[model samples]
Target: MTDDREAIVPVWTLATGDVRVPALAGDRPMTAERLTELRGVLAALADEPIATLEVHPLSDKLDRGRGIPLDAGSPLAQHLSQLITQSAKSSSVAAKATATGENLYRMVVPAKTAAQLGQGIVRPMAAKGVANGIRGAFVNSKGTIVDAASFVPVGKAAAAGAAGGAGATAGVAVAGSAALTVAAPLVLMAVAVGVSAHADHQRQQAITRITELLEQLHDQKLDDERSELDGCRDAIDKATAILLDQGKLGVSLGLDSAVHAIGKALAAADRRLTKWENALDELPEGKAVEIDTLTKSFPGVDDDGGTFRTHLELAGLAIALKRRVIVLQAVDHAQSDPGNPFENFARALKADQQRLDELESSIAGVLERLSALELTRTNSFRPVLTTGEVDRLMRAASRIRKLGDGVMVNSRATDVAIDIARNKDGSVVVFPSQPA
Candidate 1:
């Protein structure tokens, strides 16, 4: 018997970790090398023959503490919640990682698989050609796999009679949207009926492979940002503990120093946010002027690409710092509220999460404009543009684009999940729990 509780399918947790807040790479530039590493990982997943890929906001037991969710659409929810589209020619699944940018999810390329089956199935033109001919016939408009032949009756000559009948069958196979919608679920359920054991085995293999791929990924910048965010979380927790212990007597008990500590942390975060805002504000918007004019414009990159790299790096750092600052701001707001610290803090997570979204939107808008410059052509015919300058600009634009795409914050904070309870003296105790 198959263990229903057994996770036979692989679940790749792509997250920035801790505090359950929306954040990108903090204090690090997402360089071209970093972006290439990210794409390489996705390309590996894209090669997998995914049975069914579902993207959702990853939530850990800690995130849903005492039935209260910390996510409240803060981290990965904003992007993963968007539509995941499947590529007909390839097994690549693309998702809107940000409101304005698209990122690859996971899936398989049918064409690639068919090429591998060349000699095994038949001659060069037989198997490969057949697969190519029916490249997208199996997927519905929503990218769900469906049985194309299901639209017609089985074992009936009249259903596929010559000329008109065959033509109708092929048409339904290719563009029968209404019929596919009604039949897709039935096909999936039927396919899932008795393959539990096989599915479990495939899942185990996938998990192992994905784990290996993740281990191979090494981004020092992302690691540094994770540490910084952790420090910020620790700072918030420190203030929270003080408030819980002292209650209204915090000032009289000589613990008022904790308020100063909180202020310091908040100030540091604010400074980072201001720096990023000023730098980003300096970037020119693409829609503001003609593409030709934008290309001719110089936003401060030197011939060696040094200045452009600095700007891209700062933008990345800002993307990360901005997110952490949002959390700090929320905590500051909650701390000022004249209510239970625990309740107020939890409410602030959801209430103030919108700031993170706004930050992402602003970054995305700037990156979109930069992208136009990268794509603009500058040949000898257009003496106004140079190849070397455009190359440097392209590198900067690409890095900023990746930074603005936002990091996929995986749900792995259960270990840090804290629980709050009332003591006999009406005081509150926040303890960690290892949720099952």
Candidate 2:
């Protein structure tokens, strides 16, 4: 017989080397080439069938870069705690919430913030002051008086201004229009123009791919949001009955929190759903873009009359279908027996947790590797973060930690099964579980 523990999700360590968080790219600030590379990487994942994964919550946060845990709490708990602590420290107090009540302990922040108001404001401001001190050391980046003698050289500024006039053009266009340009005769000047033109084509290609992917994701989000709305309505409906029921003893103290949570969760879901609907609604008329120019400008290219676009649409549709079907398929694959939502949700959650951990490691790796040698680099020294950002981050971490501790995890399902299994066939099977 298979052991109960055997089916439990495996919690792999998140040491520095254990999980690699691929560098973020795409419509972000990373260069078009860099962004395209990243898109290819992430797109590969999005394109493929998601692995049969399980996300077992770690019982503790990994210490430093080691896979060793901070405590018995899950990595999700640590991630949540970090998120909470960081948010608590942010200047905009309202900005730190998980928006939706993803965790039951989200409510504790108002009380905690009020309790620790003094350090909440002071530490962050101090951190900002230190950061500004360092940033002010730079001679190039805009801010108050430049004190950073270590910033860019004077002559390079002119060169950069000239280069920016040249390079920034394509970056801006790709960031928005994803325009495809053409180069001059084969030379340095030609190379610059050709490079920009090439990037523009790739940018359009990526945008088309991503926008299409996002649309599919948006549909899934829409369904999920609708599900969220339904859940909220159900919770509120139950709470409404409880509120009206004078005979329901000991319900007020408990039910009030539940109702409040349901209301808050519902409102957040509404806000996000509205945002998604709005974004989806605003999709630009992509048909206006001229892929024919790229086909003609390059010697080996062929138009094929929107065939690539057709293929993109078809791929997007297929991906959407896969996502719709996969949750069911993954569940079927994971379950030792068929048709269990709790097991499905649990296993899916476990895999998500692993993925989230991987993302954290990836981000942290980038942070810890910044160097003074970075000073000599011709690349613009955009601060990876803004001032007071650390305090906000720290507070978020703390809050996530608190949230982890607040909620209890258990199997009401197992309890029910145990109850049913104990009763004899002919005997009165007294319901051992509460008749909610």
Candidate 3:
């Protein structure tokens, strides 16, 4: 069974009976409201048994949040890379979702056999396949196939022609189009600052700028849009106030609170944007946009480019503003965490920044794809992607690219290796290791 729709709640299933669900943020105990929400999300995916629901974490970088072709090069991305490589099956996508993008991995497995795959029980599960199921697990998000050298089923000749010189050398023997590789291991120099009145002022000023930007971009058209921006402003204000009031003694706790609040706001806005895009997708005019594909040809679909471009424009403004605020909140903070707090902070900062980068890249990819479609068309009789749409997309991509490049601040030069250990129950446990 193939499903190609985006859902607010991300759900994935292993061929095994086990279904993966979203873990509550941090160690927060589940509340009735939270439980209710979880139940609703689960109910939405009940039609397919053995599913996994995970929300892609939000980040300060732009390219992070949007789902796209998978990166096969990064060590961190290896798990996903391996999953696709082993499975020969496509469909690992991070779906469009509210607050943050959600990923729904589709696996072809029987409902009965208790396959322990995708549970992270075994490091890089591909080494050991399920007792009875496909060799590799399948993953798809929002109708975009994960394109990796190892994932493509076709041989080299076909893949080479399809990729059209877009392929990156992954050193793996597999057929595919251009491969997206992760940037060099991000070296995040952790920083620890003693909370000072001056730092507090800087925070306030930063928050004010974010609030002003929110005000400037405030969309009065939809209550949902307005409310999202308003909520973001309030969250920053209240969370910042709490963080400052906590004094140096409680700076760690305060920063945590602030990050959480800001992240929530950003996520809420993202969700709203996703909903808006979904509505746009339903419109009769615009053509459907697909970022992941093997061939250079744009797929033919009845999708509205005007509405879609507008959605990207709005999202670009809103997400960029909030991310700037997050970057401000993250850098040069005093944290009381154990074991080289600076490195820890740097690691966290890098992760968030990378997320933003991924998001921006995805946006750029969308615009680029659309722009290419407009340029490469069959007939000159009234193009499907109008000139105005192409121009807007190009401008948006340029602006978004600049924002993504400049988002990171105070990053250190050395890369740090992260030691990730899984508990007996298959929950991942991450801690700092020495620098790589």
After superposition, which runs of candidate 2 have C-alpha atoms over 4 Å from their true positions? 1-305, 336-436
lDDT (Cα, tens digit) per residue for candidate 1, span 1-436: 2222211111122211011211222222233233334323432333221111211122222221221111212111122221111111111222222112221122111222212211111111111112211111122223443331111111100111111100111111112111111111111111111111112222233233323332443445533433343333334334333332222223343223433433443344345445545654565654233333333333332222322333333333333333333333334444354333223433454454344344434434454444334334423466666776577556645543443233322222111111222222222221211111
lDDT of 2 by residue, 1-436 (tens): 2122212111101110011233332122232233224323432333111111011111112111111111213222233233333333431321222222221110001111111111111111011112201001111112222221211000100000111101111101122212111100001111111112222222233334435444544455434433332233333334323322211224433434433443443344344334433532343333221222222222111221122222222322222222212222222223323223223323443443332223223322222221100111112357564444545444433322232221212212110000100011111110111101
Q: Candidate 1: give the clashing pairs.
A: 14-410, 15-409, 15-410, 16-409, 91-108, 91-109
Please report, in order, the local distance difference test score of every candidate based on alpha carbons.
0.27, 0.23, 0.30
Task: Kindly report which residue stretches of model 1 are placed more than 4 angstroms away from their true locations once superposed.
Answer: 1-237, 240-347, 350-357, 374-404, 407-436
Residue 63 lDDT in model 2? 19
Could you give the C-alpha RMSD of every candidate to the true structure, in order shown? 23.6, 30.6, 22.9
| Model with the higher TM-score, candidate 2 or 3 | 3
What TM-score would every model get versus the actual structure? 0.27, 0.16, 0.28
